[model samples]
Target: MNRKQIAVVTGAHSGLGKEFVKLLTEDGTISEIWAIARNKEKLDQLISEFGNRVRVFSLDLSDRTSFSVIEKLFLEERIHITYLINNAGFAKFCSYDDITVDESLNMIDLNVSAVVALGLICIPYMKKGSHIINIASQASFFPLPYQNIYSSTKAFVSNYTRALNVELKNKGITAIAVCPGWMKTGLFDRGTIGADRATNNFSGMVTPDVVAAKALSDAKKGKDISIYGLPVKLTWLFSKVTPPKLMMRIWLMQQGIKP
Candidate 1:
């Protein structure tokens, strides 16, 4: 059987991941999408909406073994991968001392390790015009006090993405790191735990659809960074020019974290 071209998307159940699924489905070059996430029920719902073009995998990306499944699929099917969207990541907002060691490590495992592993695994299958979009955060632009571990993982993502872009340029594969600000997703509540949700509520939320739309367009153009919103663009600029200490101070003040 001649298998169809594939697009692999992680975190495919909701928010940006869901939007990415929709965008990829519209691309006629890719006929099958392998959607990976831990939420089987949500995956089923997404599959219901998109039909057989969506193949759901209920696996946790945080586990090192999970990535092996992807390699196995590629080797067995011998299909070309046109897009690899590494969108599965999470952030726990709170002070360092307050967060447990296990919690911090899990963030690193999901937000950093899994992303790196998948990038290494997928690049061999992807060729010119193929795109890999890694979901980073604007929080990565500076050292965030309350969101320390999460933001640090994102910084690694941003730096690694740029390096990967340059390396892949010769091969015609484009790798982009998308650093978006707060969005209207369920994760917003997770981030505000033990902190005042109202503190950062002033910035406003960007719809995941907008972020997904802009990212897909930017990825096709071979852009290194894809960011949404004027506020987030300005924040990225501020983080670059301002000193680390000043950026931390500003973040703390904005998040209602005391000195």
Candidate 2:
């Protein structure tokens, strides 16, 4: 007997994760979607809105056992994986030491570790035409002073996803990194300096839905880098030649932090 097809998306409750869920639910080929998030109430809402095809898994991506839960589910159903969106992550503002050790560690665990784990676990279940979309950020192109851990982790994600795309090409699996700019999500406040830097001089801002739409489309096209909006695309290009010292100072000023 053949197993059902499913899409596994972490951070499925809000932001880009939620948008991806909404988009994937429109895909007729996928039989089910294992939506993972810690907030059960939001997950409930997602299921209610998206319908029965969504299987809610209330698991925190920061936990070591989260991946284990998915593995066990795979054993039971032996599902064919279609889309794996590693989108659960967080960012805390301020200098390195000023931020709590636990906060920084949490950022690393969720953004970097969980992405690595989920991609590894789901890739084996995926074959030709499968897509893996990793939500990196425009910050991944350069170091962000006030968001050090978050940006660095995204850097790791960007590099890893690009490399994975190359390695998985022969297998017909497509893996791509999405580096988007300031998205109008609850995670960011328009009044804050952290938010200002994300908007910057280039592209103003975008909604999570827009980012998800472009990223999913790009993943389907087999693009290694998925950058939403021309401003972000230009930022990624400029980052290649921008001097590190100057970039750091510019970021500091934008965040209202003294360099």
Clashing residue pairs, candidate 1? none
Computed on alpha carbons, the lDDT of every model, listed in order, comes to 0.87, 0.85
Clash total of candidate 2: 0
> Residues 1-259, candidate 2, lDDT per residue (tens digit)?
9878899998899888999999999999999988899989999999899999999999988988878988888888868899999988887655566556887788899999999999888988998999999999998989887677778999999999999999999999999999999887755642124432332332378889989999999998999999988888887888889997888887767655565
Worst 10 residues of 1 by lDDT: 195-204
How far residue 210's Cα lies from its native spot in candidate 1, in Å, is 0.3
lDDT of 1 by residue, 218-250 (tens): 998889999998999999888779999998887
